[model samples]
Target: SSRYGEDLGKQDALGNLIRELARTDGIEWVRVMYTYPTHISDSFLDAIAAEPKAVNYLDMPLQHASQNVLKLMKRGGNRKSLERLIERVRERVPGIAVRTTFITGFPGETEEDFQELMSFIKNVEFDRVGVFTYSDEEGTPAYELPNKVPHRTAARRRTALMKEQSRISKRRNRKRIGEVVRVLFEGESKESELLWQGRMETQAPDIDGCVLINDVPEELLPAEGDFVNVEITEAHEYDLIGRIVLV
Candidate 1:
């Protein structure tokens, strides 16, 4: 419903709702997700930037970078437009964590198209990324499109894209070390009862990485949903290790 145009009274309405929720005293963070790239408005961006409680994060799915592939997918906006939009967002809201998804092996996608996407990814260096291989759905227009990518080729492309993103993610995470960040405690870490888990402002609840709380003073252990300042001690591929900063 949030994806619908303003004529449907849902697009800006969703942004209004998010703004209202951010004003609530009990709401520690507001994270917006699944914002379609073409429909993202200035008002929506302003709301995100102005609200102190709104996390500086956005989940905008680009799907693909190739102009030809995007035209086929009916998702308007080319690589240059996307770059400009992203730059504008960062300028409006500094330290924003932009997460995006891309699809590989779309119909008529060539090796040149795939390489263009890889270059785009390198240039953007998004905070988080998800990749998928094209899948045919019976009722979708793409299913009937010509020059469908081979299944095996699609799988290979997916793997290659993920590998590229892994390196970017690791490098981005490494930059967080030694910084004190506010983490919203989630629960005990799945791998160890002695360790707790939380997410920083840049991390969305479930889809993004986490900060592992280790060696915290007994009295300072935060309960689930509590926000605590953690001094990052280590950084891994997709996670961070930190100790509670007793303020």
Candidate 2:
């Protein structure tokens, strides 16, 4: 099924699909990605929350928060609506790791619009964020628009937004310290072969951060792809340090 499954007259296809997938045997995890904000219904959130196999992680791309910018981008929702949507998502699926992306420097975007976006990032404090600089593509509706944002300005805004998200990410990860969580062991870390790596349910494979295994009991060596419980000993901006508690 599509990431954000379609809604028939009376059926929520995506939510039903997730629930059905969760019921299947030998399927330990069902992770979804890139769900559009507008299409995330309560049923969808419920499917994720109620199904033990469905990972509580959402990757929604909210292109821009400013009302004007969003309108120009042909995405309808404004900051207030987006905020309400987030509130609903969090309320429905507690502790769900919400990941999102934003676009900066869209055509006709003003300084005020960019500031509004910056404030949105600070207020939302998403678990993971990605920002892109708007670039003109030939034959697109945006290409012929007036008052274009210079490439340099777009790049600068992307960097500033990322920095703010980094601060928020660090604080969020710090809260995970001392928490015992299930991790999918994935063998040696690229940083060092001496260390091992794994991903928490909240961490989406390679795109998100990882749990760096600093200590493992001699007898409980988990082969790659094994699910193990790890006790978080330390937290960095994007990674957690942990030792195997159960294998």
Q: Give the whole-model CA lDDT for all candidates, comma-separated.
A: 0.86, 0.90
- The lDDT leader among the candidates is 2
TM-score of 2: 0.96
Model 1 per-residue lDDT tens digits across residues 1-247 = 2364567655577668778999898787888778888777777778888898988998999998889899988879888999998998888889999999999989999988899899999998998999988889999888899998998998898899889899998998888888999988887998699899999888887688889989787777668888889999998777899998877
Which residue pairs of candidate 2 clash?
none
How high is each candidate's TM-score?
0.94, 0.96
lDDT of 2 by residue, 208-230 (tens): 99999989999899899999999
Per-candidate total of colliding backbone pairs = 0, 0
Which stretches of model 2 miss by more than 4 angstroms? 1-10
lDDT at 180, model 2: 94
Model 1 steric clash pairs: none
Cα RMSD of all models vs. native, in order, equals 1.8, 1.6
